[model samples]
Target: MKLLSRLVIGLVVLIVLAYAAAVGYMYFNQRALQYDPQGPITTLAETTLSGAENVAIPVDGSVVNGWYQAPAPGKPIIVYYKGNSGSFSAEHERYQQFVADGFGFVAFDYRGFPASPGSISQQGILDDAVAVFDWAAQKGFPLVIWGRSIGSGPSTYVASVRDAKALLLETPFLSAVTVAGERYPYLPVALVMQDQFPVNQWILDVAEPVLIAHGTADTVIEVTNGERLYQLVPNKDELWIVPGGNHGDLWARGIWRQAEPFFERAVATP
Candidate 1:
């Protein structure tokens, strides 16, 4: 009976140690799982957008690469922050929406992504975004910051810092840690996550006109996160819930048509 008791206690200790090790590993390497700077490159040459000029904005002694199409004078420049997976080149078609709408467009690859070079960090990307905003601001265009998926965090963050004519978010989450925790309820994301892009926390003080478009059928980063984020925006904002639209299909559901009127209201507002 004594030996049996000792064996059971030893087994419990081993399980506890293993669990701790797993948590430690996750905590240290969470950034790798979070940011993918090498997934795939999307080039501007592949798109049908005419006069899309290659742009380089210097930040922290590094250059962030993107494509820029200046709109007609007196129009808003649509600054897009992309999701984690692809580079700016992969986003040319998406930018075409803004171009077709006669809006100036600028979208850059985050540092450590293919065209941009630097280590990826929450603060690092935010710094890059601010630099890009400063560059765009000098071009004398009214600013409109837009973000999709993971990009929404930076979009909200920039809107809080800079004076934007409007802010747009698609399929956004409350925060990276919040989404991770939701997906892995058994894990302690708050304790282990490295970069918490807290969009909800940032948008609390943002007073710009904000538009949040989310899909009700999204299983990844569920629609509830988007709802919570929209509620936290303490500003002139609108939420468009696309019924039966999945994570990546909201654009197909005439999102740009919805956005056109929203942007009109945003830019027209004082």
Candidate 2:
């Protein structure tokens, strides 16, 4: 009996140590696991769209590089906030569509992306987001801001305080911490994540019309995140949960059909 007890105690000690080591590894490498700036994303050989201009906006001691073109008459400009990875240039064709439809747009690389400089953090990105909106507000076009995936953090933050006419979230999450908890259920991720972008909390404050688009098959952020966020929005416009649509494919599944009309209604002419 004494020998069996000793073996059981030793096994428990080993288990505890292994669990501690796993938690430590995750805590140290959280950012690397979350924000991936080096991965390859879809890109065009070159952007050939007409009338598009390159721009650099200074925000809180950092410069954000991007492309901008003003909309034609009676159209609201689309201020696009992209995902955590890749440059905005990957969406040049979408920009072409925006231009083709007479909608002006500004899409930029967030801080820590290739041309933009600054460390990535929840508050830092939020600060940069508001500054980007302020810069585009100079054009004085009614604004329809949209965010995709991880971009939901800054997009929701901007809508909370800025004068944007509409807010759109694509495959969004309830919050960064909530996502971490989903992916790392074994660990106490909610307590350790450093860059929690409490998007659910921010969504409660958005007054303008808000639209949420999520795929029922989105495995990255999941559809429930969008549905839950939709419930929190004060001026909920529409909840577009596409059937069989996955993350990054909602656009192909006719999201623009929904988004365009939402924009028109949000910024409808009196």
Q: TM-scores of the models, in the given order?
A: 0.95, 0.95
Flag regions of model 1 displaced more than 4 Å: none
lDDT of 1: 0.85
Q: What's the CA error at residue 49 for candidate 2, in Å? A: 2.2
Q: For each candidate in turn, give its C-alpha RMSD to the true structure in angstroms.
A: 1.4, 1.7
* Highest-lDDT candidate: 2
After superposing all C-alphas onto the true structure, candidate 2 shows an RMSD in angstroms of 1.7
Please list all clashing residue pairs in model 1, or write none if there are none.
Answer: 42-89, 42-90, 43-89
Per-residue lDDT over 109-206 for candidate 2, one digit per residue giving the tens place of the 0 to 100 score = 88877657777777777877888899999998999999999999999999989878899999999998998898889999888889989999988888
lDDT of candidate 2 at residue 214, scale 0 to 100: 94
**Which stretch of 10 consecutive residues in model 2 shows the poorest summed lDDT?**
37-46
lDDT of 1 by residue, 1-270 (tens): 999999999999999999888788778888888876775665666677877888899988789988899986657888889887867677666688788878888889889888888889998889888888889999888888889898898888999999988899989999999989987787788887878998889988788888898988998779998898887878756899988988778878988887777777877877
